[model samples]
Target: MESTMQLLNKALSVQRAAAWVEDMNLSKSAISMAQKRGRLSPVLAGNLAIKLGENPEHWIAVAALEAEPESELLTRLRKAANSWRKL
Candidate 1:
């Protein structure tokens, strides 16, 4: 049987997560672009939280997602979405 985390993984693939970022008017490539290039914008990051049924207000550093932040103020808000976390 699949472990709880494994089952969850199936529902949220890299593509799925990328699509989530794209839905916020960003690139699907943000997933890798964040690491290769830089961090993501605050709006995109916050929208990502909502896509995952999370609260942006309490959002933590997810560690595997990104988008070009819209402003300098949001530059510090760039953090991964935890897609990098695995056992």
Candidate 2:
């Protein structure tokens, strides 16, 4: 699964990402922060997924998974997300 930052980078150029951040009412540094950290907040991830015409819940799960340390639940959630994507 791609990280939320990766997804956003693939979908938007630097200028467009800035514009999107502004449009979303996020701080000017929001995208930059996410890029530096290599992840986005779950809310932002879901909203970006919506903007990209994807399932918000799936991307939100992706974001949440990225934020967590590896564990059994994380493994299960990743499997679930992958299965959902197949549907």
TM-score of 1: 0.38
Candidate 2: global Cα-lDDT?
A: 0.80
lDDT tens string, model 1, 7-59?
A: 22432553475565555665667545544543434554445556666554433
List lDDT for all candidates, in order. Answer: 0.42, 0.80
Provide C-alpha RMSD values for all models, in order: 10.1, 2.3
Best by lDDT: 2
TM-score of each: 0.38, 0.77
Q: Identify the leading candidate in terms of TM-score.
A: 2
Candidate 2 Cα errors over 4 Å, as ranges: 76-81
- Find the 10 residues in a row with the least total lDDT in model 1: 1-10
| Model 1 stretches with alpha carbons more than 4 Å out | 1-18, 37-40, 60-87
